[model samples]
Target: MAGVELLTGRAGASASALALETAATRHPGALTRIALIGNPNSGKTSLFNQLTGLNQKVGNFPGVTVDRKTGVSQLTPQLRAEIIDLPGTYSLYPKSLDEKVITDLLYDRGSAQYPDFVVITADASNLRRNLLLFTQLADLGLPAVLALNMMDVAEQHGVHIDIAALQQELGVPIIPMNARKGIGIAALKIVMAQMLGAPTVHFYEPEDELLPMIRQIRYYFNLHNDYLALHYAHQYRHIGFLSPDDRAYIQELTEKYGFEPTARQAQETIDRYTLINHILLNAVEVTRTERNEPYSNRLDRVLTHKVWGYLIFFAVLFLLFQAVFAWASYPMELIDEGVAWINSLIQTNFNGPLVSLLTEGVLAGLGGVLIFIPQIALLFAFIAVLEETGYMARVTFMMDRIMRKFGLNGKSVVPLISGVACAVPAIMSARTIENWKDRIITIFVTPLMSCSARIPVYTVLIGLVVPDVPVLGIFNLRGVALMGLYLLGFFAAILSAWAMKFLLKTTERSYFIMEFPVYRWPRWKNVGLTIVEKVKTFVFQAGKVILAISILLWVLATYGPPGKQEGAEQQVRTERQRLEQAQPAATHTPTENTFADETERLVASAKLENSYAGMFGHVLEPVIRPLGFDWKIGIALITSFAAREVFVGTISTIYSVGQDATQQTVQQKLSAERDEQGNPFFTPARAMSLLVFYVFAMQCMSTLAATYRETKGWKWPLLQLIYMTGLAYVSSLLVYQAMV
Candidate 1:
């Protein structure tokens, strides 16, 4: 028996790889653009990394928000090439947004980023199914090399391929590669650098019943190849090159030729496979030996077991949250102390009304955003490890049964879990789901899950409510509480999804079919890069919002009705004079005294009360008082709309103005806050109420922007905002009233 290749079979591999010893290798300067295209999990990215390491940029496609990655590969050190890595697609026939993005990028010859050549990656183990995409690319008449990746896995399963024979049959150079181990990467680079920008050659000349209509479209559209024209007939609705009139013309032809989309796609797929099978018969061989199921299967059997799978997943989550608190605390403290030093330095050197803005508005706002980097990085690191090691797929598989009940496919699980890091990208990730309703529902509820932006809010309030005592002598009570917050989000998402199912009506059928890649050791480089990139992106993106809003808020907090500031100053002066005069001669101390400290505090407090921002907060106080919020909390709540974590910066700036802005930490100032009655403002009941409020509220502008982009309308984003805000209000009201 031959070695097994999934979706097909393999026995062993034998061939002399291209060494690039040919005189054609000339390293003069930069080479032209080459696109790396492949099916999902085909190791194309790994090969790209092998070609270009640490020299990549992440941006968006023109006029679209899809992620685009381009890196430079040093083919021969001097013969460098710009490699564009397109998103993974199952086929050129677009079923999802990502697939549409790939097609738009490659098919538009007018675009600047169009590739001169392409490298089509096919998984050797899954050769039959992977070939479907390769065949489509070949039909476009772009010169391409086929990289059969994961050859080690194929050989291990006793799958054998005659590489030279397959190369001849396909009418293209074939390279066997194991990207994970850097096998045959040099050979791939040689072939890519050699043949790029040369004449366009195709591997397959597909014959179809639709040829007559295709020829008509080609003549009308002036297309280069019959298949290119045929694809216009196949997916003109999504092809960006086609205009409304063009699509209408294609539609007319479709009816004229009796073209059926499903039937044609099925026939083309079968024909391609039939053609591929013929090539495989003489070019491939398989020899099977006595071997039990692979180790990954054995692990999946236990890890994805009905009973144990759920339990193990929860246990992993528990440890993840617990570690966030433990590991991030040290860095957070350092950041806090550093901010305090900067605040003190500004007070000593700078004077006047603007001094407070620099210290509280800029430095404090930046600190608030930066302080959470450790926690954010840790969360993303865990997520990356799970993803890189292939455990995340299993998690999705385990959650699918439940996801279906809520009108979502297992694919929703990835986006929902990623929401814990940040909702903007999480909602963007939902585009992977083929169904619009599922994607929209996932976007609506993803914010309900506490993102990294909410961590500062949750942790700050948790300090005021939950103790740091150990639970069951193992888990910290605070850690358990945080985990509970995340769990609440998951529950809310599913319940909301279930309700929305009845609201949204669509004709598109939903399906869940995914291949669970074999588990492997986590790639540490990818893990580190993910953590750094995520943390950097979060900080800088958040810093921009925090900076602009902080300055505006400072202005709001500094000025008041002209007479009010003057009156407050007079009152502070009079109080200070009275205190100084009352002090006995023997107790007099000009430099430092308790009376001085007391006087300064009173002055700051009075100034804050009379500020314009204070008046607004006071006006809104009654509205939120039922939920255990004060005037300052009211201001923070309003500003949090910029970003949930902006709540921290808003509160920091406000509290710093009212107290000793230079000395105390934001948390310390918050802890010392009092009401008119002299009771703690952040009472456990009040803190818990706020936590519940943030947990359910959609207080992120970025998330709303992404939702609008993905859904392409304001209706869904507005509805999401309204629903989440209403839920937050009622829930926080109930909790605060009950606890108080």
Candidate 2:
């Protein structure tokens, strides 16, 4: 099976040979690679999802923040294809790091894998702007096809486009498509297959007037910077090349040619615009009225109003959090019960050290983290809806006013909201903010948003201690308390941002320049894709950490120093023999049965005390004695560092290991547990203290890793870890001291 190769431009002979060899060795004719390029909001991704379904992966471009999405699709029974969704950009001329990635990949100047064939997705509603990019690609003389996307929208708006005429003018196949509705995909795929074996086609030649300008720019470019001139010339010859560097060269040439750089660049831009404008003038005709009504502006009136906007946004956020608890609670309970049942089934069916390890250690530990998927999925679902509907942009626009007071950009809203899901992605999302100071401040404060990782700890503690009383008429006290924790995080973030503003001095002008993409109905396909990707990420990323920790925890709780195992067995045997000897043959009546039960209890108690987990707990008793924590709780806390949800699993495992009877339930065992003084270990006060501890603790390593990657150094991550951990310790200490 031959695997697909992504070539940006026509690969050099040596590179081509190497790629072909690798593909042949890897999988002969088993793979096909396709590239999807489009102007922003052209529904390219929708089409990608429709084609690839769930078989996709998202990764970062080499040394850049842009996302590289690749997926496999079956175009025919005999043809399998790999599709790459390129970053959304207005033009090929790069302005941001993300745009540069697309340009570099197309030009084969960077490490980006090039596509075998380019699928140019153009929005029919905004064909003029879309065509500017399309024209540039066609000029590059590549084997390309055009996807005239959102044709339904164009028809509804009474815009007419001559597909045949357009194709003839551009010298490429054009397939009118409504990607959202899955229209014209079959034809597009057929065209792609047909063009795979076709020769490269050039669309248009430079005009006489533009030719002189191009030559003059190339001359200056060659004179001032020979390397850059040669680079662009090579790209121009092979890849469809248009870049900021080209524009810069042109501007510099104008300076030498007796014109201002700004004026000349502006003129060049306008000239290109004029040419595109004339082409569209001939190719398209609009019958609909030119309406001045911008949908975003109209929605913004209510969504981003001075007074009502903030109130509405906060109210929506509150509802979202409340729903995360209320709506997801039933599903969460189901998941928990399901896991518990499975554990019970496993224990009943098998009896051995390996079985015990598998059930109590691995399954139980993983269940702790997996059980929270419902809530995380719900949170992401709501976020996806908001984003797809364009409500999130309004959120940024409205929040910008408030965030500016604390010296943060409105764009920080995305990161802040993302933090609720997981601080790692939220931190990474901060790259979208253009200003350096704003980005840093956003990064610093993003972790303060109560992440989903903390929810497990919060939920366990809240259930254990917080009363389920009505606060006002409708509010639950427990829910209100949870809300307060979230608010505390939010306020802390604001305070941090303010402090950073004062400490870090930079004169980067903060601007609220964001495209308010036209509102559209939420595409279920896109929403589903987002949810699947996010949940998959959570499971795999967090699962690896939890699995490792669970194994280690199993070892620590299983093995003890010296002859502990032998001693425990000996104690159990002695207690059993003593009980058996005490039971007289004639005295085995109803009262005798009670006596025998008491004897069995004693034997079980002796076995537990001498067991591995019990002995280990006793050793750590001195260390956690001050904080109202026993050794079992200490172990739970340690495992919680992998993920907060593991607290429940750790406790369950510890209790089950000590009991030796796999049939015993965690809740039953927990309820019956006693401390050294023969009192219940989990008092209301102690549970509250534990809850407070978890609420503030920085226990998750993944969050720290993400923060490090986002901040580009350890300074921020280290500070976050130290500060959050310190706060957790101090807060827990104070709570326990006050309570006890």
| Clash count, one per candidate | 16, 12
TM-score of each: 0.81, 0.71
| Local error of candidate 2 at residue 190 (angstroms) | 2.4
**Native-vs-model 2 lDDT?**
0.68
Q: Quick one: best TM-score, which candidate?
A: 1
lDDT of 2 at 630: 78
Candidate 1, after superposition: displacement of residue 196 in Å?
2.3
Error of 1 at 360 (Å): 2.6
RMSD of each: 6.8, 8.2
lDDT by residue (290-377, candidate 1, tens digit) is 6767777889988999999889987887687566657777998999899999899889988876788888778766775677677767
**Residue 403 accuracy (lDDT) in model 1:** 88
Query: Looking at candidate 1, what is the lDDT of residue 77?
Result: 61
In model 1, which runs have C-alpha deviations exceeding 4 angstroms? 1-31, 197-209, 350-357, 409-440, 450-490, 502-510, 540-542, 560-563, 575-592, 625-632, 639-692, 698-722, 733-740
Candidate 2 lowest-lDDT run of ten: 1-10
lDDT of 2 by residue, 489-555 (tens): 7787788788888988765455556666667789887898888877776667555565666666666
